[model samples]
Target: MAETITIEPITRIEGHGKITIILDDDGQVSDARFHVTQFRGFEKLCEGRPYYEMPAITERICGICPVSHALASGKACDAILGVHPPEAASLLRRLLNCGEFIQSHALSFFYLSSPDLFLGMDADPAKRNITGIIEAYPEMARDGIRLRKIGQQIIEMISGKRIHASWVVPGGVNAPLDAGHRQTMLQMIPEALEIIIRTLALFKKTLDQHREEIRTFANFPTYFMGMVDEEGNLEHVSGRLRIIDAKGHIVADAIDPADYREYIAEAVEPWSYLKFPYYKPLGFPAGIYRVGPAARLNVCNGCGTALADQEWAEFREIERGPLMSSFFNHYARLIEILFCIETMQGLLAEPAILAARVRAVAQPNFPEGVGCVEAPRGTLIHHYRVDEDGLMTWANLIVATGHNTMAMSRGVLQVAKRFITGAKITEGALNRVEALIRAFDPCLSCSTHALGQAPFTIRFMKTDGTILGET
Candidate 1:
């Protein structure tokens, strides 16, 4: 007889996801399927819109990372217009991207995944949440919330609105950077840095405290991909593509970011609608790769900034460098927080950040283009085709969450085997399984707003299709 276990409507993560475990006749782990449930038609609905409308239109896909979509879409517009924005425009774009990184990572690390880490994975499920987190570690919770507020402040300060679709227009950002606005952001950076330092210290202590748990918690290796600076330093907003194997070896190093079409091949598994993307060097299933902060750390040689560089060295010294487990991904995110704030500090030092040439005037003429940026969640790619009149003909988006679909499914099985037992399910076991998935901090809207469970009935059957055993 075959046995099956299902983990449904996974908690603490954005959108939805489910895990189905199928056991063979011998009852050994045989198969696991991660299902994404809802269907979103954003890609389908955007057809025939003017290219300029894409920045605002695509921003609606996910409230979590709208600037990501806008930048991606706007890069396509820059190509269509045959002009890159002025230096100040580019700097302003980087400014907004750092804001996205800060806020989104804060939500993932502190709001969603922190409950399990800080509260203990085995703690009562109903109580193991942000609320519970506040009750238990009020100061830590406050720091996290404050960090997210700073990110929101940066976004609002620059884009003129806090969340979901601020103005990052075609040639550049809609508004110039004001001295007062710069000073406001400058004032906030020191506080944000302090938050990151405190959080990094806490995460380091937690790593030592939960040594055994961290090792066993969804530990597996796969290909890693992300953008990195020329010297192979981690690059969140812009850089070249770096792909590395599980052993911390750069299998494909320094590939042009825009030329990712040459190395990426998308595969559709019969079990779900989300497509699995793999390294072209290796075949599907075999080439299953991961992308995100964890993947970014794994692929990059260093973080380039000071404190983050120190953490990077310390991170590598951890028996294993570049952390393969989902547990350390949380810490890697904190390291990124350190890097983003440091990088912002550097960018602000440049007087060009306050320049008035924020938007450039250009004639729309080109036919197509591709834009690449690393969203807080992972690497995001947006490619658009347009007509001579700047009307979008077609669009393709590779969101950060989509890059982790394979790993998410792989992680589902790993966690199910460890937590989902055959005995009457306890909330502890179910919460553990969900906690395992939330480590990915997936945004289904970026991939597709989808994930849920369907009751499955399996029975023994003969060759002629006659049922031999039924429940």
Candidate 2:
């Protein structure tokens, strides 16, 4: 008999999901799938709204990466208006994004993932949480909290609210960075940098303990994708898209964000709501690519910032080719936090960042536009088409999490084959399976938003499609 093991509602992720590990008739792990069970209809809901309302509306996608959506949407609207924001507006936007990167990466590293990395994977489920980590490592926990708070403070200082702040507009930001607030944020930088540096040093010392995971955990060859400057420096707010293969050779470079639809396409799977995106030239599954911290680091020549550039060099030294191990996403994420702080400090020191002319006046001049950005998770693209009256006719959003959906599914299978036994699945093995998903740091809520028929139940069927069971 072919049996299947199902783990429902994978915990510690942004939204609800389930994993099904399929077994062969011989009781050996055959394959696995990651399913996003929820349906979010953001694209369909925004159809009749004005294009100008997109920034505020799309920001509701995920509480964690709302700023990513807001900025991308704003950029798309900027295209529609045929106007460019003032330099100060662009600087402020980058500063806000840096804050987002710091807070979000810190949350993933400390609150969600530290328990598994610091404590044993087999630790009691109830005890493997932020509270547990706090109890075990009080000072470290406090540092993480303080670091996250500093990022949130930066966001609030510029945008006026921590979440869903409509500060970014079509052509630019609604306000400039206040002098007093800028000084306050500048003061917070050194402490934040110290926290990340200390945490990174401590994490580096533990690499020896996770040698097995480092070697086997989703450590496969896949093309990497992210934005990069013209000089191939790491960029978060704006840049051209770059895709590189497993051997560190650039497959595509200087690709325009406006032409994304020509290069990228989404593949729908019957088992999950999330769509799989692939490079169009390579066709469907073969075009699979990984994004986020690891991918960004792999695709970029340098981080452009001084301290981060030094860390980037060290990160690349771990592998002659691109770093393929998902386990290193943790390290990549911390280094990004360091980069975020350094970049934020540099932006604040610029006098032009305080200029009062933040926004440009414009009316909708284009019928269609596309906007792209490096969300904390990965590459995020927003596309929109408007009617003559400037009302949106259609919208498409490719979130960072969706870009990595194909890779995450494969990661589950790889981990299952390594850790799970069909005869008996232990808690430790199950934890490792879930850990693989966490390694990708996917945002299910952001990935699953589309209009479609949603299947609420998952069927456990044989390879030949005979139904074994459903949940």
Candidate 3:
């Protein structure tokens, strides 16, 4: 009979999940599954709310990435009003989003994922935490905190709060940037740039140590997707959809955001609330693709900024074509930080960014709207239908992490097959399985819209229903 081993609540992650390793009668690993065990139904919850309130209401999705939700929601509301925000307001929104990417990526790298990268997967669980990083690599730890704070400071300067400011609105931002605020933010950028440059250099050298991981951690070929400027430059706030294959060929380019339904589709499985999004042309599982940092870099021809462009060139040189390993998300993330800082600085230097007229007032002019933005994790889409009175009738949110669900599942299986052998599983081997999922830096809380505390239970049992162990 086949036996089952379950790892409940994969540790050092944002939300609850379990990894099930199924062994055949002969005791070798046969298959593995990653289960998302919670659901909040944010989409269903938003029905009947006023369209203008979406920026505030949907911002409650997750504290870690509420700004992403707010911006996307605000953009959708803008569509309903049939108005484009003034140039100043648009620039301010982009600056806010850049801060979000910097902070969120920093958290993933320093607090959650760094422990494994620095302390080793097999290190004592007690010694594998931020405190551990602090004690062992004090300077690196301090730099992480300082860098994250810089990102947060920019958000606070512009929006008056760190997490959910509710400053974004249907047509534009609530306020304009003043000269003092702009200069203050610019002063902080130079130091942030230094940190990103230093960190990327160190991380690239660190990659040489994990030889086996570089090759097998979610490394298979697949399609990549994200937003890009008209010139095929990396863009976040506004751009057309672009999809590239693993072989470095552009499969689709300059795809209009409204036409996304023609290219992307979602699938639901009994084991998870998060839907699996795939390339519509290739169909379900076969059309599997990746998003976020690695996917963004793969789809764009350049980073658009000078420093980041140089880094992008070097990143592509690692494998000759589109980088396939999810492991490289860490590197791509740092390069983005550099790009964000540079881009934000340039926007602040423009005197027009502090213009007094930041908003454009208008009533709802459209019955439906779709908003898309490149969030820190991946591309986020917010689609809403409204009544004539401007009240929301329906909403569908395709979050960044949700888009990578299928890729994460495939990754779990590949990693399990590579590591798990025989019946006896070591803690080290199990942790490595968890580490592969972390490489995607999935925010399951945002992915599933889950609420409340779910129980974390692991069980070891046989196919005959006999319980052998439980945690």
Top candidate, metric TM-score: 2
TM for every model, in the order presented, reads 0.91, 0.94, 0.93
**lDDT (0 to 1) per candidate:** 0.77, 0.86, 0.83
Which residue pairs collide, candidate 2?
A: none
Q: What is candidate 1's local distance difference test score?
A: 0.77
lDDT (Cα, tens digit) per residue for candidate 2, span 345-450: 9999999999999999888999999999999899999999999999999999999887887677667777888887777889988888888888888887787776
Estimate, for each residue in 138-250, the C-alpha lDDT of model 1 and write its tens digit: 99999999999999889898888887655888888788887898898989999999999998888887776666456655577777899998888888655788888777788
Better of 1 and 3 by TM-score: 3
What are the per-model numbers of colliding residue pairs?
4, 0, 0
- Candidate 1 wrongly placed segments (more than 4 Å): 1-4, 23-30, 269-273, 449-471
- The candidate that wins on lDDT is 2
Order the candidates by lDDT, highest first.
2, 3, 1
Off by over 4 Å in 3: 268-274, 450-471
For model 3, how does the per-residue alpha-carbon lDDT over 1-471 read when each residue is reduced to its tens digit?
A: 888889988877777778888888887867776777777878878888899999988888878888888888888988899999999899899999989888988988888878888888778888888999999889889888888898888898998899889999889998887678888998898899889888898888889877677777888788899999989999998898999887889999999776778899986544333356778987765677889998999999999899999999999889978998898998898999989999998888777788888899999999999998898889988999999999889988888887887677667767777778765677777888899888898887777763222332222333232445433
Q: Output the TM-score of candidate 3.
A: 0.93
